[model samples]
Target: MGRRLLLGMLFLLSVKIMAQEKDSRLCLGLNYGFGSEFNNTDYTFINHFYKLQLYYKLSETKHFQYEILIQPEINFAKHQLLNFYFVKPETPDYQQKREDYTQLKEVREYVLNLGFLVRKPIGKSCSVYVLGSIGPMINDTETERMSKGFAFADVLALGFSFKMKKIHFDIRPEIRHVSNAGLSGKNGGYNTRNIEFGVSYSL
Candidate 1:
């Protein structure tokens, strides 16, 4: 009876170790981003993002891993516009339009990104990944380039992740497009190139 109880305890310990190994697949990440180089004329956009990321494993391969990324974030932007081409020459409010488009504006956006990532391990502690994401955004201010209210942000990124113990550090460079998809008449949007840094902890 003593020997049987000892065996049962060892089996339970082994099961707990396996559960720990499997539970480490989930992670939480905090990311920050910076962007510049607007695509439209007379427009300067300074962009920043604070992201809370929840990572879920989608599937796995022998040499690659696939993950689902969901991010809820806040975007703060500073905008400067010095040109006015949206209004025509004969329009009644042409001068007023020009005046409105020539000032400094602060815009805030609420964003949610649903993403898919595929990664390949380079060695024991390093990996490379490609991520594609698109989601909705709520624009809190209006501009000559685009309307306020509803839009979408699409992103594509390539990055590397370095794991140190239970924490991961990531460096990513990405391109982004923010547009209304013809949902509004004033749908000329903003385009930017960005770089992001992140730190994550495994569950």
Candidate 2:
């Protein structure tokens, strides 16, 4: 009976040590990004964005890992002008009237998102992952004819990660979409494609 008790204690200790060796509990990351709008024809320059993320490892196996993450992001862009030119005829006469007006300027946007990440390990320290996120977004430029103050945002990303001791680095290419941009009467939404690089510290 004493021999069996000693063996059981030794087994529990080994299991505890194994759990500690495979720990990837929590992570914090920051990323920088550069991107451009996909459907905008008038924009001349690519935009700059930044993100801060917090991740919690929900579950893991020898080959796969799953995480839940929250990210807050912001984007900065150049101001743009929308011009409308109209030509009208007065009293059905030969004379014509022409008028032009400027509409709205594109500015900055802020987003807060919650997402899930699925990672598959390829080697000891290298992995590939995919992520999807959805949340709320706000833009600086909100007008009757343009995007609203609140909108729904969605993100999709594919990336690779390299783990080093307690630190991990990631490079991801992502696509983001905003629905009902500016609550504008025209209902023209927004879409962007970007690449992001991030460094994270694991706990």
Q: List the residue pairs that clash in candidate 1.
A: none
Q: What's the distance in Å from true for residue 46, model 2?
A: 3.2
> What shift in Å separates residue 20 of candidate 1 from its native position after superposition?
2.7
Per-candidate TM equals 0.89, 0.73
lDDT, model 2, position 103? 33
Best candidate per lDDT, number? 1
How close to the true structure is residue 178 of candidate 2, measured as C-alpha lDDT?
68
Q: Model 2: per-residue lDDT, tens digit, 1-203?
A: 99999999999999888777545677898999888777544433357788898989898988889999999989786533332222224323213211211332456778898999999999889999999999887777743223547777788999999999989999999998767643554344556788999998875
Q: 1-203, model 1: which lDDT tens digit per residue?
A: 99999999999999999878666668899999999854656689889999998888778889999999999989999877756776567757778877876778899989999999999999889999999999999998888778899999999999999999889999999999899998976787888899999999887
